[model samples]
Target: MRTALRPHHLRWTGERDLAHAIYGTVVGTAAMATAGAHRTLGGTVATVLVTVAVYWVAERYADALAAAVRGPDRRARIGRALRQGWPTIEAACAPPVVLVAFVLVTGDLRAGVVVALAVSTVMLSALGHAAAKHAGATRLVAVGCATGSAVLGVVVILLKTFLH
Candidate 1:
């Protein structure tokens, strides 16, 4: 299977969106934890998972709403919603899983959070690079795309820093 970081096919385009969601979740969750919210690692993981689930559900709901508005058939609209929103819902799982794994292994909650954030940023960077290469962009353009995507992660990090 192609991952966001090593994507090599058209079907892997969904990885790009996953990369963004993962990064956003990691950064946002980490920030909230550091703000004296997550007193325990388990609590942090649970909170993040809940947030991810909510996001996934929200995406599905929005898609269903759009499908209903665009078409008249109930079954067809439900199918359209599933097709349009499944990628994002699936991708959104990556971050919470990563966070949970780290939290479970590492005794230090802060360190676990940092590691999760790093992993998410790396995934985003890889997705950016793969997307550019898949588009047959020049080396400079590819590099730019990678850098730009990675920078978005940094923006999240900055938000964590200032907001926390």
Candidate 2:
């Protein structure tokens, strides 16, 4: 098999979208983790997806508006804003799949939720490390960034634990 194309290999965009990706992952994971147990798995998944989509749209809209104030082409600016933020949606795609797969195999929605949160936490750490390294941080700084991100994720999980 061919080697997987790393984000660093991208031409037009490297880790520029990492911020949005991290945000999306956090949003998705938090949504799944905190969704009440009364919700069916499908309902929880739908809620997570809709929540992410809404957040993405709201953020992009604000970006577009900011760009419009600085530029002349409103339509093109909006298009660019949406395109730039697409990584947010892409990043959120994995957690729902994890939730579904775990629920299917374990026959437990809560298990699926915790597993999905863990996966998102891992993604956040990796993204943080990549962002720091891309920014030319030292190795220790990169590791610190990753740890900080993971801690934030853990806090979200803990909130879910207390709430549920």
lDDT of 2 by residue, 111-131 (tens): 788888888898889888888
* lDDT of all predictions: 0.61, 0.81
TM-scores of all predicted structures = 0.71, 0.88
lDDT of candidate model 2 versus the reference: 0.81
Which run of 10 residues does model 1 get worst, by summed lDDT? 1-10
Candidate 2: minimum summed lDDT over ten consecutive residues — where?
A: 3-12
Model 2 TM-score, all chains together: 0.88
Tell me the tens digit of each residue's lDDT in model 1 across 22-82: 4444444444344435567677666666665666677678777777776458778877676
lDDT of 2 at 156: 84
